[model samples]
Target: MLMSPTNRLQRLADDSSANSLSHRLRARRFQLFEQLIGGLDRPLSIIDVGGTNRYWEQRGWAGRDDISITLVNLEAEPQVHANIQPTAGDATDLSEHADDSFDIAFSNSVIEHLFTVDNQAKMAREIQRVGRAYWVQTPNFWFPIEPHFLVPVWHWLPESTRVAILRRRGVGWAGRTPDADKALRVIQEHRLMRRSELAHLFPDAKIVGEKFGGLTKSWTALGGFPALDRVTA
Candidate 1:
């Protein structure tokens, strides 16, 4: 049996070469958002679905007291900071919040886990309803390497073969879960999006591509950029 590649997330935590290129790409993506939101002079209200305060902190924005961040996740996060509010809710159904209640509805690396296109659509609609603008992102299916597994052409393989590979030597972060059944679950739970699908979800939004080694690795739908005046630094 072929051994799986080491888990990429663990490698990321250790700052391994495997994750360095991808991390740099991700950082650039965040910078793009920062520049896009630079025009706003007042405090920004942000609703982050499937996010945590730690995530904001990691982004180096948790200390920005001027920004009010509400995080909505399926699992409740411990209240670790006053500036960040944590709430438990489903991304697809955010009826508790009024329409346009937030300046931005942001999510990252989440849509693929929704397991169905309908669920993805529902989440997109809710994001639109709750926020005046939004930034939603997901991995690009056409990328040669699968972001989750860090395996080239892994996602395009047959299910049984994929399961067998996971059962033996699992690769990437999903492979780190030694249990084959759990790995199978991880494989089944994700569905990467194509450019067309992403465009369809947020029709009015500007579609930004995140490139890795000159290949489009992911895409972000930025809903509010068109309405903002280009900011001069």
Candidate 2:
């Protein structure tokens, strides 16, 4: 049987698929991340906001003694790697950690899930405060296809329309729900961001566009990296 577009897109996004576009892009992103932190001679400490043990495992960084990673999420994840520490925390307020407590604060495709601009700002602020350097990636609002829904122009439609669509059938990672309240909540949860908003949030950082098919797909806000000029240029 042929797979639906949503299923096809979701399969392409799975980290285990080595040949997937999302995996390849993520690998490239990690290479850039390594370049950003390559200059440091000592063991590196990183705090991954909304990260997972499997994410690091897939990236081949799970058990490396040269670096340690703290995975933070709403609920603590199970610890399966010696070098990875799982912690329960709120992204909007990371007061549990002191200023510049980590070498780098990393997040991927997590900022938009905050549901509001104010919450996004708070998370951005907390990220900057807790780490000397930060790397944040989010889907570009102007991208023709919404990454979550696997639907073209889905994000640009009216909220009522989006809710109605979700009510009818499953879209990407989200399953079909007959409940209007649940569908509306699902539609409102993901708020794709524009370049201007990211720039405003990280004024000191360099914004680099991740392009596909000559169009900007996502944006990464990078700060305090010595190779910023080389990478951005």
Candidate 3:
């Protein structure tokens, strides 16, 4: 299906690679993290679920040595900087970690991949259980552009239509092939949550917006950040 002119314009404006929008959003998120961590002393312990060391490396945060990070995901022994530790763990069940095991539980673009609302809830509960604070980010369902495909409103289509499109090669944002069976399998794993769903999932956390073109592009749920009250105040 062809995108309307208005949607095309919006997609162009939201394109991550074509402009500084993604960069600006990431910087803003980092600023929020800094604010949340402001009252805390150094050598913070963080458990990053569904995250890799490359994310921290890209942020290039100052005083990296002062912060201890653990990367948790399905894969075993993820490659990371010497300063970071890697652990194999499930997002829905982190039973190995006791309550408040880490200063922060961080996840980026991970919740949507849970494939089900129940799974997302379980993961949310686990995050809340294991960490004193948490920060989780996921693309907004209402956003005109889909982050993975960079396509305008592709996710708005019916599931069957989306699967059909996925079966066909070379039919996605900017001439990318997203129709292979493997791609379809991966795509099925993602079930984007609306703002309300996010709120329900993390009732204690504040839902924050990351916007592009004056529209919310993604949502971040911040929980248990000590300075959050002061920062928002």
Candidate 4:
């Protein structure tokens, strides 16, 4: 059965649109998890650090005894879902738990939220300390600062200049230093890590996959994400 050129063109257009849409949605899902934990399947021990996550409770993403979840926050456990255990703690210090505590430790845009580079490193160590493997998501520094972590890794800039620029842009103003600490509170999101940065952090840990992350626009290959695959010791 031969088709007309018009039908062929339409089919091509539809196929292109569908492929583009699927790609966009996949990237968006990663971004959403950077803000909140969702879309993961199965019942398992999931630990979220340093943010508010209510998706499992509302959506019932849990899979029974095979999966359990907890939130390690900076404050007392909130009165909420019976399944979620919110614990008062810091990401850097999880001394409260024994070795190899949880199956998956998750944090999105969290490390840059730390007050200092040292603090961020400590948080990373602790995450490695507890979980089997981690799914730590942040932004690529080359982009602009919409949520936080400063597109282009503004942390490397002179504090004065960074402040002035963000100030003019109506960010990190009001006498607040526009660092990762401020980002954690203000933007609630952040830039992803650079290639070198991720390598240094993970060190011996294998990097399974990475994706270019963004909101609604195109992201260069260099400005994508670093999704991890790990073999727990």
Candidate 5:
């Protein structure tokens, strides 16, 4: 039998490629998800908002068993088993799926990508519509620097100064669509959400936990960025 992706990941601990960031992020997410949904055996369905097949692959492929992991993205679908289906769609509108179709819907650093305030609110509604619970996490805005990938909390910066900071992050309105830039350009606006801000989306959902990532020593150590994990409406 072929070695599993998680096992392979262990062997790749020393990988030096720059693309390794994506892999490491995915691994961290899997660990967090495993921790959250540890007890339940065979959830009826698990939808990963803006997720990839890498999720199923990393979980020894067992997590995908009986789990309808519908990867939501604007890009083309990835190659995965039937248990993993990729849909080219928007989170603001998930009307394609039946109501209560998924036991859990996961989104990591995705809500910020929404183009409009209305769209972001609609995305929350869609997630709440399809899944029994939502597992969403994003960079905390109350801190300093840009939380994009733990640059620091830039939320404290004034709009004029911060937008310039975001321009440095490849966000420009010159060629971008008004809707697409709502989120993609928020970096300059210092547009991260605090715990209260997130709570507003799902007033009924409680904040289950918060975590500060990194532990120093690592170059990209984001130990400062506060990450909130919530199970809300």
Candidate 6:
């Protein structure tokens, strides 16, 4: 059966299959993450902002005695592993965690969902304050395709045009929300970041680009880690 463009993109975004593009890219990203922290001799504590237990479990980090992972989201997720702890919190305000409380503050594809650049900056500040080291990733604004919508040039379209498109049909992760206002709200929630913006947000961090077909697909701000020349994804 032939898959539509929307369906094909949704499939590519799915992380359930080890063979999926998202999973493969994430696996490669993890390798770089491991290298950055592997030299440490002590047990590691990680506070994952807007993260899930499934992410760590898939990477075989769950239930490890040497690592403790605290998953933070708007609502606490169901507990599935002893080493993984779920907590309800806002990414923009991680006030519950003390300064340098976690060995690493990690987030993946989350900064862009904050609805505004101001909120994104708040999250970046909080992440830096709470963890001794941090790693944050977001979709690249220059990428030809809008990852969330699975639409080519969707992010480049004007506000009214994006809303109209969303009201007509289901796209990637979002279903058709006939209400114009609701569709507009959904469109406003996702704001991709450019390399310069990321660098400005985390001035202390090194900006790493995740590339596909020689074009950068996403950006990662890496802070307080040993300098590495490159990480190919």
Ranking by TM-score: 2, 6, 1, 3, 5, 4
Which 10 consecutive positions of candidate 6 have the poorest summed lDDT?
224-233
lDDT of 1 by residue, 126-182 (tens): 999998889998999998877777778888998777888887775676645567678
* Candidate 6 residue lDDT tens string, 170-226: 887889989999999899999999999999999988888888888899999998865
Q: What is the lDDT of residue 192 in candidate 3?
A: 81
Runs of candidate 2 with Cα error greater than 4 angstroms are none
TM-score attained by model 5: 0.65
TM-score of candidate 1 to 2 decimals = 0.86
Worst 10 residues of 5 by lDDT: 217-226
lDDT of 5 by residue, 126-157 (tens): 87788766677665555443434333334465
The lDDT per prediction is 0.80, 0.91, 0.78, 0.52, 0.57, 0.91
Tens digit of lDDT per residue, candidate 3, span 135-221? Answer: 999999999877765567877877777766666643433333454566666566877879999999899888888877889888999
Find the 10 residues in a row with the least total lDDT in model 1. 9-18
The RMSD (Cα, Å) of candidate 1 is: 4.0
Relative to the unseen true structure, what is the C-alpha lDDT of residue 188 in candidate 1, on a scale of 0 to 100? 82
Q: Give candidate 1's error at residue 42 in angstroms.
A: 1.8
C-alpha lDDT (0 to 100) for residue 43 of candidate 6: 87
List the candidates ranked by lDDT, beginning with the highest. 2, 6, 1, 3, 5, 4
Give the higher-TM-score candidate: 5 or 6. 6
Residue 228 of candidate 2: its Cα lDDT?
A: 79
